[model samples]
Target: MLAPTVGAEAAEAVAGEEAWSVHMQNTNVLQGHTKIRSPYYGTNSLSQAPQMRQTVSLDLLLGLRLWSGAEAHLDGMMWEGFGMSNALGMAGFPNGEAFRKGTASPNENISRAFIRQSIGFGSEMEDSPSSSLFLKGRQHVSRLTFTLGRFGAKDIFDSNAYANDARTQFMNWSLMANGAWDYPADSLGFTTGGAAELYLHDWVLRYGFFQVPTVSNGISLDPHIWKAWAQVVELERKHKIGSHPGAVRFLVYANRANMGSFQQTLNNPLRPADITDSRNYRIKYGICLNADQEIATGVGIFTRLGWSDGRSEPWSFTDVDSSASFGISAKGTAWDRPNDTLAIACIVNSISKVHAAFLRQGGTGILVGDGRLSYGAEKIIETYYDFAVRGWLHVAFDYQFAVNPAYNRDRGPVHIFGARLHWEF
Candidate 1:
């Protein structure tokens, strides 16, 4: 049941929500990395040779007001490209836009189709921010919102103003998100689910339930309805530090799916380390903290901390048990380039002891397997500069340096360079 609009008769109420809205965006990313040290290679290993890749994506978003406090949105998306080394090899992958299942030929999909019902609880109203997924209108300061349909879990949880969007911010898997949470998603990152959000002034609480891929990191979602699913809850607080704004979010998520265990795989003598052989319905959970603060005018800093019980195999997201990241985002106003942005971030990713041992015995997850694990933490540093070319066009340059690439100490640090072009209005 939908919550009735409480202040529909007022000018600043929900009735004034947008009648219709349309937005479009396109992006092209090209990246390359030079050869790196590789004593050996496994079924899933970063290549030892120089490599480059390009990816392109187009998105069309439409929104319509359905009733006093309800709206619907649809996303038409097309993507074509491949990640370097087929999107494997690194736990903290450098390119956020790259998907594991890449295609040279263009493909289309209905990435998002959802309906949202908002319940206002206060008379105080404020203008909503611009977004591809949300309709613009005056909204209650304290309200409850319910959304149902196909979308990305990130759309409602673990958000940071400075480090969340790959198109406009730091472009690394772990930098853009808490790698260890492994929130529900299919191969392309979208999932079918429902979420509820309760906003009260500077604080909010959110929860979501989503479907996971039937097979680890596979594109197809589970067919058995709620049998294979994931759930997440988050609490967020917003406040002013000095005169600048800041926010912190704490998230916890659990997944129950047909998954394998690292320790079990290693214990099975017949099959030295085939995790899939021991698949069973199991529950896995994790917690993540995300924070961002605007320290000064046009200058903001962000950080994320994450951990998960690593006994079970990674079901969808990359295999990471412990993760931490810190970064700075600054506008170029000091240099008089008001529309330019410069950002840098660093990420550290690691697996549990049992996970390391499993890999040591030649087991593999979604990414990062060297056949024989050297058991070193994967570390990465990334920087990018983006400048506006026109009203709806922008271009960026990016670079990344990684040590112990793919958790193998035998491999030397690697350097990757990239460029991106984006258009949206």
Candidate 2:
């Protein structure tokens, strides 16, 4: 059922009760991907496979007023699902086991339950889940947030644009291409611990550590990586150019993610003697710029540019030069109706060939050192549309294409398709 202008009425009716909101989205999809490999590419050829994937997700927000002007907030999400293509197949050798077992992509694994809470220092308010939960005064100078449960990470560009759960194609593809995370499979990807976030003035910082699977022969449920750490800091100064609604934002991030390091078993299935030390021990620094313009009453255009430098150069492992990569995205949205909207976006990525020299092979593999690994250029294009059928239900469609898919011959172009049915409460 559709309800019109219920904001004021709902606020009045729930004056003394804790406020909460929940959102759920279910998607049943069919995918058909064709990989084109020429003789010049290599000795390998791909099979045209038509795959099917399905998923269900829930996102929740809980808010409670601690005082007249302050509140306590908790947010969480859960995913039960499946999808296609695990990046492990491309993350070098031996890591692709999880992807093969699912008969689908690795991102479709599963999402562990999670929750985060913070107390506001001031009196501002939040009307949507996307709104800041910090109090008015606290968000001005400093605010602190802590999480002790299992959960996924959020993206800097737009929380809704990139996948937060890391349990699906849309999210995994974007993050992997940007070199954000080393998630080969969904269920095996996230850490089991907690994190904290602090905001000070125009700068925001976060530190988090998780319990991940180790490089052993255990199943997906087994934890091994011991510990995974991630840190991100953002600083922004919005400059108004004339009366137009235009602004710029800057972001920086670093992560030490150990996605099942090296092992003689599953991680190094190629045999200890044949196993190569291709682990991705990364130290990364990145920067991004975001700008937007209100072109019309129901339309807007936005663009973002980002670059990263990985000092450790996972490809090289040791004594290797760092690697640099950059990406750009342009988006347009038409909000003609309050409940109905059409959104479209395009993105591209470029990684310098110098990074290829960092790729190393252990023992006696097809390719040794940097000579066997070279990614001249790689790119991906993605677009999706969401239409709110009513207040509680929605539908979406997405398409993706990849070119010069990085990695050796065993992997394909990474093409994908998606459809979703969503309901929110």
Candidate 3:
């Protein structure tokens, strides 16, 4: 609930047609796991014992219309708690809310402070509805939009309506974004960057450049922007399939950072070949294809396929060099509950031969590091049901089954269960 002062400020913004607006939301998620089989464990391995974990987050969004076609926004966030196994082991982590830097107590920070400018090119206009960060207004259909400041790479790329937001949709990290893109970010999953988008009729083009962490999966970003940076470009098309709407996006990304090569790490016999020990300003590249379609009145299907250069170690994302994920979501209108949702998805993740060899030699990456390697592609199946308790509250039950977790055949076929509660106003 909003305090009286905040409520009054919101009312004034609406009533006076003021340029400034404020919105806030909170989400608390509780996820638990049932024990599975595991003969041994490593430093980054998931525990075979049953465990439960919870995370809580709060976000306050403030937006100000600086001038015609320009806006400034800020996001203040507070996060707390950890994920199962401290968010390690799996190439596709189970909980999207779990951050590598999670703490038992709450931590506050400014997640985003940015400026957006839109330059219209065509006379055609469209309505832009109000959301968590965008203000309600109308804008030209053909325009060039630029955003600058601190934010998340996922905030502007690889978006799927049926399977994007973890707070309201799928909970798995692989389902939330293309795992092989390795988009740049710190431990908390955000970075300082800039993005530009060109909108045309039925098509859009996007490009972004962002900062990378100082080290692989590290918490601090590199200060020397010229020495380390990540770039991404995407082309998106909107189409109709038999009177149903659909969209497809093709994306490519490159990162130039102080990173190590998989083969180089393995070939160095003088020392225990570790990726982290041999950092140099090298480049890594990847591509992703994402698509979504509405097949029926209340059903939608989405898929993502991604691949990265197998030679280099994963810098900012997971350990997967190749990935494919597909899912379907349906509304519960048939059961007289229009606001409820049901979804299921399957994901397959694999590393390169060199990466497998490195792991076989007991080399560790960001997430997976079994003592020894029994290489196999990691596969997962996930399902969830979300029930809307009221206008502003929702509850969800989720389950996941994994085969060859962390790409190790010796480990498990594991089962995981979760529950989530979310509220926004």
> Whole-model Cα lDDT per candidate?
0.85, 0.37, 0.85
The lDDT, on a scale of 0 to 1, for candidate 1 is 0.85
Off by over 4 Å in 2: 1-23, 38-52, 55-82, 85-142, 155-172, 175-178, 181-189, 192-228, 236-249, 257-298, 303-340, 350-374, 407-416
Model 1, position 355: C-alpha lDDT score: 90
Cα lDDT of model 2 by residue, 193-223, tens digit: 5556665543455565544333311124234
Candidate 1: tens digits of C-alpha lDDT, residues 1-425 = 00001011112234555577777888788999999998888877888899999988888787777886788988888889988888888888888888777888998888889999999987898987546776668789999999999988887888889988777777888987899988788888888999999999999999998999899998888877667889999999999988999999999999988999887788898534898998988889999999999999999999999999999998877878999999999999999988899999889999899999998888888887778878799999999999889857789999999998778898858999999998786
Candidate 3 per-residue lDDT over residues 65-179, each given as its tens digit:
8988888888888889998888888888888888877899999888778898999987898876666666667789999999999888888888887877778888888888888
**Candidate 2 lDDT (Cα, 0 to 1):** 0.37
- The true-versus-predicted C-alpha distance at residue 331 of model 2, in Å, is 11
In candidate 3, the residue pairs with backbone N, CA or C atoms under 3 Å apart (3 or more residues apart, or in different chains) clash, namely none
What is the Cα root-mean-square deviation between model 1 and the actual structure? 4.6
What is the overall TM-score of model 3 with all chains considered together? 0.95
Using Cα atoms with residue i matched to residue i, what is each candidate's TM-score against the true structure?
0.95, 0.60, 0.95
